[model samples]
Target: MIEEQGIIIALDGEFAEVRTQRRSACGGCVANGACGTSLIERLFGRRVTQLRALNEVRAGVGERVLVGISEAGLLSAALAVYLVPILGLVLGALVGTWMNGLLLNRSLDGSMADLPSVIGGLIGFLLALLWLRGYSAGSSKRPEHQVVILQRLH
Candidate 1:
C-alpha cells in the first residue's frame, strides 16, 4: 500500500474528502537534473489533490489523517491507462499497414497510408479514453477501489 497524509476537508456519508498535497517524487531521483520532467516540475511545482477516502477512522473536517491505497490497484490503473492505448495504437497501425498493402497492391498507386495509420491511432486513443472514463465512473461507487483512511493523524 502507498500511504500519504491528508487533511479532511469535507464529509459525505461514509467518505471523507481528503486533500493531499502532490509532492514530486522526482526530486530525489538521480536523473532529475537531466530530464524534461524537471522542467515540468519547475513549472507545476506542488498541487493539492482532493480524493474521496473511506472514512473508517471517522475523521472530521480539519482533522489530519493517514490515507493508503493498494499498490496493486495503482499498478493496474497505470497499466490500463498507459498500456491499453499503446496496445490499441499498435493494433490500429498494423491494421492500417495491412490495408495500405492491400489497397496499394490493388490500385498500384498511392503510399498515402500514413493518413490511415494516424487516423487509426487517434481513434484507438479516443476509445481508450472512453473506456477509462467508464471505469473511473463505475469504480467510484466501490469502496475497495478508493483510497482508505488508515488512521487519524496529529
Candidate 2:
C-alpha cells in the first residue's frame, strides 16, 4: 500500500475528506534541476490535494490520519488514464488517413487529408472521454480503487 499523512477536514458518513500537501519526491534526485516536474514545482510552488478516504479507523474531522491505496490499483488507474486517450488519437488519425486516401483516390496534394485527420482525432478523443466516464463510475465502486484511512496519526 502507498500511504500519506493528512488531516481530515470533513466527514460524510463512512468517508473523510482528507487534505494532503504535495511534496517533492524528486528532491533527492541528482537530475532534479533538469526535470520538467521540478521546473513546474519551482514555478508554481506546492499545492494541496483533497481526497475522500474510507474512515475504517473512525478518524474524525481535524484529526491527523494515515491514508493508503494499493500500489497495483494506483498503477492500473494511471495506465488507463494516460494510455486510452492516446491510443484513441493514434488509431483515429490512421483511420482518417485511410479514409482520405480512399475518398480522394490517393490525391497528390495530401494536405486535404489534414482536415479529416483533425476531425477524426477530435471525435476519437471525445469517445475515449465518454468511455472513461463509464469506466470511472464502475471502478469507483470497487474496494481496491478506494483510499482508506490506515490509522489515526494524532
Candidate 3:
C-alpha cells in the first residue's frame, strides 16, 4: 500500500477532506539549478492538494491523518497521469518533423532553426502539465488506510 500523510481540513458526514503535501523527485536532479519545476516548487512552497477519503476513523478538522492506497492503484493512477502527456509530446514532435519535411520541400538538417519542432515540444509539455493537474484533481477517491491508527499524537 502507498501511504501519504495529510491534515484533515473538513469532515462531511462519512467523507473527510484531507490536504496532502506535493513532493517532487527533483531533490537529486542534476539540473535542479536550471529546472523550472524546482524553482517553481521552491517559490510556491509545499502544495496542499485536497483529497476525499472515508471517514471511518472519525477524524476531525485540523487532525493529522495518514491515507493509504493499494500499490496497484498507485501504479495505475501514475500511468494515467503521466502517459497521456508523453504521448502528446511524441505525437507533436513527429507531426512537427513531418510538417517541416513537407514545407521546406526537403528534409531538415539537424539544425537548430526548426521553430516548429521547438513550438511543438513546448506545446506538448504544456499539454501534459495541464492534464496532470486535472488528473490529480479527479483521481482522489475514497482511499483505504492500511495501517491501523494506534493513537493520535495530538
**lDDT score for candidate 2 against the true structure:** 0.87
Clashing pairs in 3: none
Root mean square deviation (Cα) for candidate 2: 2.2
List where candidate 2 sits over 4 angstroms from the true fold: 30-37, 108-110
Candidate 2 at residue 5, lDDT? 89
lDDT tens readout by residue for model 3, 1-154? 6667888888788777788896677878889758888888888887778877776778788988877668876776778667877887877777777777788867656675576776776787778888788866666542422222222335
> Which candidate, 2 or 3, has the higher lDDT?
2
lDDT of 3 at 59: 77
Range of the 10 consecutive residues with the lowest summed lDDT in candidate 3: 144-153
lDDT of 1: 0.82
Clashes of 1: 0
Tell me each candidate's RMSD, in Å, in order: 2.9, 2.2, 7.0
Q: Report residue 67 deviation for candidate 2 (angstroms).
A: 0.6
TM-score of 2: 0.88
CA error at residue 128 for candidate 3, angstroms: 3.4
Q: Comparing candidate 1 with candidate 3, which one achieves the higher TM-score?
A: 1
TM-score of 3: 0.55
